[model samples]
Target chain A: MEVKKSFEEINEKIKNGTAVVVTAEEIIDIVKEKGLDEATSHVDVVTTATFSPMCSSGAFLNFGHADPPIRMTKVLLNNVPAHAGLAAVDAYIGATETSFDRDIEYGGAHVICDLIAGKKIHLQATSPGTDCYPRKKIDTYITKDSINEAYLFNPRNCYQNYDAAINTSGRTLYTYMGVLQPNMANINYSTSGELSPLLNDPYLRTIGMGTKIFLAGAPGYVAWQGTQFITEVERGNNGVPTTSAATLAVIGDLKQMSCDYIQPAVFEKYGTSMFVGIGIPIPVLDKDMLMNLAVENKDIYTNIVDYSVGRRSKPSLGKVNYAQLRSGMVTLEGKQIPTTPLSSLSKARAIAQELKRWILTDKFTLQEPFKHFNKVSKLNTLEEVGKGEIDNE
Target chain B: MSKKAYKQRIYIEAEKCVECGACTAVCGAKALRLDKTTWKLIYNVQKCQGCMLCVSACPSRAIKSDIEDLPSAVAAAL
Candidate 1:
């Protein structure tokens, strides 16, 4: 199919409220009925979304300066420990970090959620007296309003594809994948089926550095390639990985975020995490991009792995498509195994629909990626360094 | 049926509470409050009316209740 509009022209159409925007959920049915050419010509943007519990997420907050401006060496937010190793007033609170009071019910993710919910959190910090900054201790209550800057600068957020976890052993397993029933009785998957952001842009064509995205509830950008991005994974005919592959590091202003999009989640056994709602708008640059966006649940595949193993490389039972997974049942060894998703499909749809409304109303505009992601980056496995071996590569 | 026909009470597990204040928001009886210092949910059984609204509103399944069977002597005495 010959392309008629450039990215700039599409932006012009978006500004004028003339661009045809549909969500990834809507485009599947559109493509099925109208074919790729007709769908590509009709749709100017495809909004993709996913609401999942991302454990490797955190927020960096600059609480401004205290009265005496203490160089905070140790920090705690609502009993949850935050990394105060940065500047005097800045700290980073990871999602999975538990409180110093050893409360499993609350964690860093809960603190971030409480702040977003417009609730005040107790902020306590300690520092030795310094020459320039003489304050030694600070104990106060802080809300989102009290902090000068509170932004989520997650090192990793969206995964291209992930594995469905099941336990084969006689005992149950408490993992980041959620609680898995023993003897492969139940499986837990964590993707939003077809509406996932990375799955929509399998090859990372429109999603890259400086790409504007709906993060949590605020407008954010792709900061960089996500940590532990395995780009060398096996791909299907459409260049979409069948297993774990690409990821995106994103950053967004926490002050602009809403509690509706970002929620604190506590797994029954896996502790605390954040259910981050992310939406990315893919500008239909060409027919190939349209086809990628048209990719459905049956086209995307992931492996069901046994999480009972204690090693990094677990045994994979077999491959399963998102369609089968989303059906809430998949056959494993001729037996029907019920499936549960850790991600919320309802929340994902809400985000996609919300983003679609934003684009349709000209409230949110599409952004051209400053640079496309590198395809040749290799993921290295972790290895223990031998003593007295100064290996320099 | 009278109000005393069924024995009811609200069970609040403070250990399971994340202090998100969702239960407090849904509690019409104002039985639940967050301790500002400890950031924990404080439940007053006297103020609770066994509405069970907080039980369903709790995201963490922290709140539960049991309906105790009253003895005939106790019911008659009351």
Candidate 2:
């Protein structure tokens, strides 16, 4: 039989304040020094993390019914439009939704951050009145405390891997990846390198649907596999994908979240977004998991893609590992270009440490996913149908 | 609020700043970026129009806004 540990066993140690927990970064040195066998046997949990701009993040809010309730047909939070297609007073504010009256500077991320900071938010809604619920329109203010429920329910986040970006065009390209300098003058990338949760468990062995995680400084749960949860992507020698891979949909209480972990960001001419800090503690279920946790920055690789093409299928420029990306420069076509890792590494390190402390102090417990994610293979595409004939010219 | 009416002043605490380029991404005035020589976050007070976007974009919370008392070097740059 193989050496293994159970969630019950880890929780028992956590309760007694005896579980040996380390971050994915710390596990590298521990394995390097003590050897994989000794390190795997000693470590009970390893936390992985990332604090990066997650564009597919949002919050669902349900304000309790008013005196004579109105079914909200349109909703706006602090001038930012929210999806009001849900129930009477419930709405989903996506992070990327820009303010109706302002530029990209103010948006759903600002509204979400204001709510998290306990600042008041301007709320406005319009509805076509009905007999039972006969209110026409509403204009009011709401804070996180004032709302009945405010939860961060992101559809896609924690991207397993993202290919670095470079521009081969004549002009600077303002993209979600960052400002790509013209003529391949700069290479832009975003990841916490080895500390990323999905990279640590590419196969989704220990991470599952019910897995408890630190989401935006709050204890949250993995809702499901995210929007583009592809598994059949190309991989490097280290078992990590070199392209965009698995993502996670996470849910947490917005009231319990802090502004520090959910900071807002604005990409010039692109849109508004937020830095979603997510940390997952991978319980050392077996030596295989521990070995996975011990993976380092050098082994993880990503490809540099040309963003100048402006298409779904951009051409791959070159294959580069995280080590080369982090070194601040990469050689593409016999020329060196400066690089920028757009994600906040300091915040990622802090989130990992915070998650480690949560487990060591017994505040968090490991959960084997209630159900393993559906092994989705092929992804479908939206077909464009023209009434007459498809024009290719 | 007139842009010229208010005298805006700001400073980024050097030791606490992480030079993550988050500020550079949001800065509309082109006042913030990591110095190519030292790779340290540099704020060109001369060029800063003081929209204060960097204050929120900074992950370390090192950027300060609306300071009445200004250092001589910062004032000179301004």
Candidate 3:
């Protein structure tokens, strides 16, 4: 019997600047164990965003951290199952376990397109009424004649048309939005308009899942306005230091977009099939919105929290806050890679039978006779040459 | 036959309880417990619902709630 958070209701919602949401089963158990397909595959990318039958048999994927980034990564890879390799998983679940009822407004992109098109579709967006608006033509196009005219002019099409498309897209429609500080230090942002290189470019390079992703119950807010184009690179400095001009345009754009991690040839080109992990879903921060953003922007810095997870980003081993988040199983380690395991229920039937045998294996050919793990072989190429089949080979 | 009488008040605070288990991993009213031998933070106060998130995560502020201590703990639950 315990519960609290009252310093005058956390200083009147951070002195009325408002913006804190997170719920939907705390963003589907932190994207079923922190997202980006659990950081480049190993199953458990599952998401319905919130309550459903979801406890495995997963494949929901909805996410809309305030849409319009190539239509939110093409409606999260066109509602799953493209090329069927799997790993759609991103239906908006970055932070929540408390602090909701932000006046119960709704329609985070039509409740993520009616929870990935299970219904409704009155889709409308023409926006251009000034300040940073770029959703020109979508006056009604989630096809099939707008979901049969949005279920024949509303046969109780609930979630209230995502609150009428967030009141005609004035845009503060967030339901479980993420990253409360994610600027793993490579900041640079000077441009003015037309944004969305994945949400107003802070030097985009955010590939997803399984590298620890969880942030429960509000509190995560790290949008540090591109940490004022970072400069501080003095610890180790293996390279990239031609006497600052923003570290020579951030080390000539991280040596033409290489963003670290290629050593041992990317673990000898996927030996052990390249597995990385990160699972963070620790949000319980409306301590009066971090004490009114640390008393009005603690000298206005804003790197928007990236608190490093693994594989040497300034070589970390801290910052996994919310009083050290917990609640049944979560592991991640590096170098010799021992810790792994992030999704549970006893490692989900041996990681879904090793991702269904690494999707019907092809084990880089050794020219015949190698079919081990329970049979699979039918390789042919003779061109019907009756007589000496392999003689002309 | 229903009357408006459902007061609130359910709290805990065994010295800023650090037996982490995140308020019993989000207790929808499993009625909080983390006493694996004197970790000290058990409860059954009629399966509480004043949900203050263990008093906004008591890093040692300890928990609190007292809506007149819920009609004498619901009159010792009937």
Task: Give the top-scoring candidate (TM-score).
Answer: 2
For candidate 3, write residues A1-393 as lDDT tens digits: 122333244235334533132321223344345542331222211111110001101112322213442132222122221111222213221110111232112212223223233444333323232344334333333422222111100011001000000011222211111111122211111110010011111111121111111111111111121111233322111221111111000001111111011000011111111011111111122222221111110111111122232222222222221111111121222211011001111111222222222222311100111121111122233365666555744
**Native interface contact recovery, model 2:** 0.16
lDDT by residue (A282-390, candidate 2, tens digit) is: 9888888888888887888888999999787899988898888877678899998777777777778889999998888745889989988877677876678877766
Candidate 3 docking quality: incorrect, acceptable, medium or high:
incorrect
lDDT of 3 at A334: 22
Instruction: Tell how far residue B13 is off in model 3, in angstroms.
Output: 29
Instruction: Please provide, for model 2 over B6-78, each residue's C-alpha lDDT reduced to its tens digit, 9 standing for 90 to 100.
Output: 2356766654454466567556566776654344566777888878866655544556677454455555655
Better of 1 and 2 by DockQ: 2
lDDT of 1 by residue, A146-198 (tens): 88989998888888989999899999676777666678877778887688998
Let me know the TM-score candidate 1 reaches against the reference structure. 0.84
> Clashes in each model (backbone N, CA, C under 3 Å)?
0, 0, 53
Per-prediction DockQ comes to 0.05, 0.19, 0.02
